[model samples]
Target chain A: DAGITQSPRHKVTETGTPVTLRCHQTENHRYMYWYRQDPGHGLRLIHYSYGVKDTDKGEVSDGYSVSRSKTEDFLLTLESATSSQTSVYFCAISESPGTSRYNEQFFGPGTRLTVL
Target chain B: AQTVTQSQPEMSVQEAETVTLSCTYDTSESDYYLFWYKQPPSRQMILVIRQEAYKQQNATENRFSVNFQKAAKSFSLKISDSQLGDAAMYFCDRTGNTPLVFGKGTRLSVIA
Candidate 1:
């Protein structure tokens, strides 16, 4: 179990409405990531941040946007919710990618989001 | 881009028995990392095992072990003395310098 927490463990929003999910970490890790899990898709990265204000798009980042203003918090926002975006979202933290200490990422419990 | 493939969509094993889950990946990078993750009904992702490409010896953690064949581009997970807690969706992943690429996943059912 990591010291990571996602706010609004379960959310249901209507279509075309704005939605935001928050990921907060107490480990002070350097890297944080947002991932979405679906039935067929194991887990797809939506966005990642190396440091505060530094973020990169992942394989599926079309409808999602992210912001990391501080080391402990990362936010994922959907401007307009869609049915396709309904899935379980997970937050991960790692100290370093190449280093042995942080080679493996620690995942949060996850947040289930539903859109109608 | 790197890709991970889990051939078996589902597997079953009796309690106290051993079961193996197959995984294969495609990548051009010589040095990388491979991992097996387990997600239970609670939807919490847990790390089962990890294997470094440079290490010839397979990695093991308690009852979980990996059979990594670098030349064959295959990394399989073996669970010994399976328990009810072992029943879950297992995912195989690979990563170099980029983000991890995961397979579709294999659901394991532990039958008593």
Candidate 2:
């Protein structure tokens, strides 16, 4: 499929442990984002990258970290996992041309992370 | 900051019938985009339809269409001849330089 794939569809980790979620895209998009979804808060952005090695934080970047060392892969790391970090994480990519509105985002199946 | 709102938490429609899900948003930027995403039990976020802010024409994809009221800052989704496959959580989103801001989502139930 010409889409994005997220590793470890489901994971359970202990508190204070370091966990990393990987997002790989075959579409070669310029923009990649990490978002977490909870029950009533909809989906909140954690981090996003405009290009390779160019990234910025979103509204919810407190305990999360992200890296976009290459164009095809974006990794999100939980420095120290907390129970509050337990949520469904999603990776999205957009192929917006120069104007940055050329295409909509494509999301992966999402990784269900449970912090114990 | 932009915010998307889906007032109806849940909705139900009979098969072959029509149903509309309401979405409201607040954005100061005039040039942006709106989208509807569907997440089924499989947990895959699928793009149902999209609308460019500058365009006046409504976007339609198969049985899915959008009634976009830009002046009102309201965008609602209409499903014509709803099917069982339409049962999923539908989310309205607004996008700009920032990542897409999504609504809480409305879970739709298709009764056959």
For TM-score, the strongest prediction is 1
lDDT of 1 by residue, B1-112 (tens): 6789999999999999999999999998877889999999988899889899999999999999999999999999999999999999999998777888899999999999
Query: What TM-score does chain B alone reach in each candidate, compared with the true chain B?
Result: 0.98, 0.98
Task: Give the per-residue lDDT digits (tens) of candidate 2, residues B75-97.
Answer: 99999999999999999999875
Cα lDDT tens digits, model 2, A19-41, are 99999999989989899999988
Give the root-mean-square deviation of each candidate in angstroms: 1.1, 1.3
Tell me the TM-score for chain B of model 1.
Answer: 0.98
Estimated TM-score per prediction? Answer: 0.97, 0.97
* TM-score for predicted model 1 compared with the true structure: 0.97
lDDT of each: 0.93, 0.91
Candidate 2 stretches greater than 4 Å from native = A97-99
Best by DockQ: 1
Find the candidate with the highest lDDT and give its number.
Answer: 1
Error of 1 at A73 (Å): 0.4
Q: Would candidate 1 be rated incorrect, acceptable, medium or high by CAPRI criteria?
A: medium
